[model samples]
Target: MKIKNRTLLLPLAAVLCVAALTGCTRTSYAIQTNDARTIISDGKPKEADSGLLEYTDANGVKQQISKTEVKQVTELPK
Candidate 1:
């Protein structure tokens, strides 16, 4: 009886471990607005499916970064 229980529990434990590892990873992104406002964009923003932040530097060059890949974000004084 104990042997049969162990056999059943082993498979269930493996499935639970796999499910936890493959679960969606949540991330946060800092968006620098056009008006110099900073915001955190987690979900898909209007037009972008990846919830990426868009901004232009002093040179007027556009740049974008996805929320998922952003480990951390910091703002510097202009």
Candidate 2:
């Protein structure tokens, strides 16, 4: 019983470690709008409660833009 438990624990621990580290990787994104303004986001944008598109800027600041203004969203190069 002890050996079986120990065997399972190693793989379980490894999986948990991998999952923990996975969240550390952040992908930046670029939001192209109808206007000439270029928006760089720290991560994927989300729809806020006010119905505006909310995203974290490259400077770590939170910003919101109207949905109508967004032309396209593309993942930036890593």
Report RMSD (Å) for each prediction in the order shown. Answer: 11.6, 4.5
Tens digit of per-residue lDDT, candidate 2, span 1-78: 999999999999999999999989899998999996789999999987776899999899999999889998889888
How big is the positional error of residue 76 in model 2, measured in Å on the Cα after superposition? 1.0
Global fold similarity of model 1 (TM-score): 0.33
Each prediction's total of clashing residue pairs, residues at least 3 apart in sequence or on different chains, is 0, 0
Error of 2 at 66 (Å): 0.4
Give the per-residue lDDT of model 1 (tens digit) for 11-59: 9999999899767543444555455566554433333566875645444
Where is model 2 poorest over a 10-residue stretch in terms of lDDT? Answer: 43-52
Which portions of model 1 miss their true places by more than 4 Å? 1-4, 7-21, 48-78
What's the TM for model 2?
Answer: 0.65
